[model samples]
Target: MALPLVLFDVNGTLSDMGRMTQHVEEIGAPPQLAGLWFATVLRDGFALTAAGENPAFRAVAEGALRVVLAGQVLNRDVDDAVAHILTAMQQLPVHPDVADGIRGLTAAGFELAALTNGAATTASGLLERAGVRDAFAAVLSVEDGPGWKPAAGAYTHALAALGRGADDVVLVAAHPWDIDGASRAGLRTAWLNRDASPYPSAMVPPDHEVAQLGDLLSALRT
Candidate 1:
């Protein structure tokens, strides 16, 4: 039987966001603000989506960064600091398990693709930098979709773009919200629970759960 197409979430799931803290410090902001700044970015994005609008991820992120860094004692101009951090985000490296996990899945004959709330170019750059760009059939961004993940239309848009049915695609993500969204859209979900945290009770449960990406090879095969 042909293996299902696996759609992966790029940011926190595949690429590590820990590098953001380093970028934050490099720009003279408190390293601790990195997490909060990211959270604010997501919050604004979701707000825009909820209001029936889809804004570009870079715009939202840059705006959020400016607000987050406004009161900070930055070594450079606030705009320069924001630009530096945003540049760092674009060049982030994939997680340690990503290379092996992607190779294993490809060897198993499963097609791979990436779907991100950020720009597709960023996703492509990330996989390319990690030497796994060719492994994906496509790298999609929410900018091309109806809205971001946690919205059913976003997954449906991706399925349509990939020329696959919802049942033929499986969404692999670290966020329960992404899992829930894919599940509601009639796609299978695999939660990459690297942190071993409890799944959110408010969302649908994932069909498969693994502590790391490498474990997905076994999870999908079975």
Candidate 2:
């Protein structure tokens, strides 16, 4: 049987956002603020979606950055700091295993695509820089969908675009909320547990769990 199409989550799952800490520190902000800023964006995005609004990722991210940086004494102008962090986001490198894993999965006959809460251009740019952009059949964002992920509409939009039912696609993400959302939307899920963290008990557990992206080639085969 042909393998299911592999749907990837771009941020955190593929891109190495850990590099953002350095960029954040460059503007005199605490390195830890990098993580907090991202979390804030997600929190605000999710809140907007729950209230029946489809929020733009960049807008939310920029707003969150400004709020997070407000109390910090930055060496540079605040607008410049925001611009710096946003540019850094566009240029994030893929994780070490992404290129090899994506190639392996493609060579094995599994079609691949990307879905992100952020911009499709960012996801495509990251993969393009990693020399693997051609491997993905499509790079999508919530902008193309009804709402942010964890909302069924986002996965549903992806399914419609793929012209496949939920059963024929598998979502691979590092976030439990994303995996749970995809599962609830009727797609199979794989949790990319790069940090060896325990799966959260409150969410729907993923169908598969791998320590890294390349492991999916073996995990799915079995």
Which numbered prediction scores highest in lDDT against the true structure? 2
- Quote the lDDT for 64 in model 2: 95
1-222: candidate 2 lDDT, tens digit per residue? 868999999999999999999999999999999999999999999999999999889999999999999979999999999999999999989999999999999999999999999999888889999999999999999898899998999999999998889999999999999999999999999999999999889999999999999899999988
Among all candidates shown, the one with the greatest TM-score? 2
Off by over 4 Å in 1: none
Q: Which 10 consecutive residues of model 1 have the lowest summed lDDT?
A: 144-153
Screening candidate 2 with a backbone cut-off below 3 angstroms (N, C-alpha, C), the clashing residue pairs are none
> What is candidate 1's lDDT per residue for 112-132, written digit by digit as tens?
999999999899999999999
For candidate 2, give the lDDT of residue 94. Answer: 90
